[model samples]
Target: ILAKFKSKGSLNLHLWTNCDRKSMSPTTFKSQLYTHTGERPFACILCDRKFIQANLLTVHLRMHKMEKLYLCSTCGMSFYSSGALWVPSCNHTGEWPHLCKFCGKKYITSGKLAGYLRCHTGERPYSRLCCDKSFHTKSALNIHMRTHTGEKPFKCKCHKAFSERSNMKVHLRSHDKS
Candidate 1:
């Protein structure tokens, strides 16, 4: 049937079949019927988003109300999932759960491992619109933006403003002389 559809150079096949158990497998036909009918059994009570499986619905519920089931033994920190608790706890005890394949360096979380991998790849995802320069982190990119904008956000008691905090600290020391 699929070969005939492909031969015609078009894929507009109307699959209208009688309820014959011998023609098609019951399990396959049921799944196809569900896809066409949009029959989603599992539904979220909070958002009313439907899922085919109950386990998917249960996982989706976490976004609405996260229940902290796992607790860190070392820091007493609670996490919604076991993986979240395990990663930071490993970092605290100097235990590297995840390792880099390129440099043999270790990281507690997969996210840290991914960021470290970018250093080897030289892939800076954060970029500035004003300049062609890029940074590894958003905070670094934000700080770099102040150089272009000349934005003095930090202020002192003397009403003196500075672009960077370290510059403001240096200015404060001159006041100490008096």
Candidate 2:
């Protein structure tokens, strides 16, 4: 069953395995396959970092010259993405507007609420094709992929690299102490 065929007598095109033709076209479906395959075709010319999609590469490139349009009024912290600015803004306001329908748990952001819903539903949409490891969020899956890709995105002034940002932040403390 390599390819599903209609008996219309024409040669059928076999889609790549793990592609869902029902939801998306073959081209778009193949593009998303990069995530599971760890095929980062989109590269950041400045840093030589790669991404699975153009949009993700676009977002990453913004960090190099971040405009910081979304600012936290309370702390003066700024972000290129509005979603990134939401946490501090909600924390300062002490507002939990988004509520979970299943558990009635209050969350500051709808994204958090959606994540919480996944907990209740046990739905993990993002999965690693290599190990079958699944994650509720794509970012988490991407981070998990570093184990396989050996991609240490977090780098230090001394050229030391880390898989996790927090680990890199902690390593940076040693630099400060020196």
Q: Which model scores highest in TM-score? A: 2
In candidate 1, clashing pairs total 0
What tens-digit string does per-residue lDDT give for candidate 2 at 25-104? Answer: 45555465664466889899877588767877777777867666777889999887776887888878788999898878
Per-residue C-alpha lDDT of model 1 across residues 38-111, encoded as one tens digit per residue? 58777778643566555566656764576667889988888766667777777787888789999899887777
RMSD to native for every prediction?
15.7, 6.2
Candidate 1's C-alpha runs over 4 A off are 1-88, 150-178
TM-score for each predicted model, relative to the true structure: 0.37, 0.64
Report how far off residue 111 is in candidate 1 (Å). 1.8
lDDT of model 2 at position 173? 94
TM-score of 2: 0.64
